[model samples]
Target: MTPRLFAALPVPEIFHKEIRRLQKGVPGARWRPSANFHITLRFFGTMDGKQAEDLDAELASIAMPPFDLTLQGSGWFGKLDPHSLWLGLRPSEPLAELNAKCERAARRAGLEADSRKFHPHMTLAYLQGTPIEKLTRFAERTGGFVTEPWRATHFTLYSSQLSRGERNIYEPEADYPLL
Candidate 1:
């Protein structure tokens, strides 16, 4: 079966609690559980079995050095009416390079080069007609948010399956380790 997939850097388990704490007080926001926290490198959409295998091989061949990443601040995707509530990531050159590589891997796997600029953030929640005031307040309150630094040792290819309750269930299909 074709699997809807993406490449992402999973937030380390240790900081899950701290991340979850920031999800409160946002009305009309369907918060993501800690288990679903990830910073997507590339969203591959749906891929057939052959494409999935090819993508896996392309990603596995990437040579990237491990780097430290820090999560900080909070923000939403849209301006007036928010589309998603997310925690920001401190910019890192290594992280950008890694994302570029993943984009290349997607191209090698015969997918179109993802044209969107990489916005590094872990989605905390998706908004559905959420109040502008509430979203603004949440962003202001968590502006100083910063997590303990973590080393990114690997990136994972995840298959996205829609589970009950409209929540997405992401199953890691492969791990591409970095040196």
Candidate 2:
């Protein structure tokens, strides 16, 4: 069997609630639940059972120092305009180091390199029928909004499930504690 999995740093409940609150002001924007908020370190699209098990074992052995992270701004990623709405993560060496550790773990588990630079950000919404004007306006308004900071003590391996709902739901396959 193959499963869609990824490693990420979960956001705290308080910050999650704050993000939901901000979502209220954006017209026609769909919000993701707090439970679905995370800073994705690596995305392993789909892997067989053997590969998954090996990854779990490697992740279990990975070590990382705990760190504090803050969501400092809001932005979007797209060629012509904003496509994906995301909250930018503040600069923290520990956070970057932890991400690197996860990347190493992925390699140790025999996964291929992603080839893309890892920018730490918590995804808030995905653009579907959003117009360019609205996206640009929102980006300009909230580009410097700073959310509260919190300590990150752990990261998890999550399996994503596609649904017809507003946001994608993820299930925790395993969790690894940070040092």
Candidate 3:
């Protein structure tokens, strides 16, 4: 079977402790493990070996200088249902350009255009039937969260595997430097 894949910049390990501190206080929230923290550039979905190879070749063609990124604020995706919680990032033009480049690579590899708008963030947790008030309180408490700027040196292609009764496993397939 083909692997589900995505391209993303992994969150630097320096900030994991602080991020972990904010993962609590929301009942029934499936908090993401620190190992899973990343800002996705593109979700490629499931791909055959040929498609994956084409995508890797296309991605390797990307060229850009490294840029700084800062974590800021916190929020949820679904307002009414509150499906997921995330930590936002300070806006950066370089990030947008890299995302666009990834999109172009995907198309060059014969993948369909991604319809979802690019919103740079690191997902904190998955929510299920979480009360709005609890989500609000969690937001209010961590709303002003911010982190020191960190350099993004490279982006990676990762294969995701579903593990029953456990967090999804993400394995890095390849790395593309931003030099």
Give the Cα lDDT of each candidate: 0.91, 0.81, 0.96
TM-score of each: 0.97, 0.91, 0.98
What is the TM-score (0 to 1) of candidate 1? 0.97
Q: Please give the TM-score that candidate 2 achieves against the real structure.
A: 0.91
Worst 10 residues of 3 by lDDT: 160-169
Number of the top-ranking candidate, with TM-score as the measure: 3
- What is candidate 3's lDDT per residue for 66-160, written digit by digit as tens? 99999999999998988999999999999999999999999999999999999999999999999999999999999999999999999999999
Residue 118 of model 3: what lDDT?
A: 98
Question: How big is the positional error of residue 26 in model 1, measured in Å on the Cα after superposition?
Answer: 0.7
Positional deviation of residue 93's Cα in model 1 after best superposition, in angstroms:
0.3
lDDT of 1 by residue, 1-179 (tens): 45599999999999998888888898898999888989999999997889888999999999978999999998999898679999999989999999999999899999997889899999999999899999888989999999988999999999998877788889998899999
Rate residue 169 of model 3 by lDDT. Answer: 90
For model 3, what is the alpha-carbon lDDT of residue 89? 95
lDDT of 2 by residue, 97-170 (tens): 87788888889989998898988898888766677777777778778878777888889999987777635779
Name the runs in model 2 displaced over 4 angstroms: 25-28
> 78, model 3: CA deviation in Å?
0.8
- For model 2 the local lDDT of residue 24 reads 47
Candidate scoring better on lDDT of 2 and 3: 3
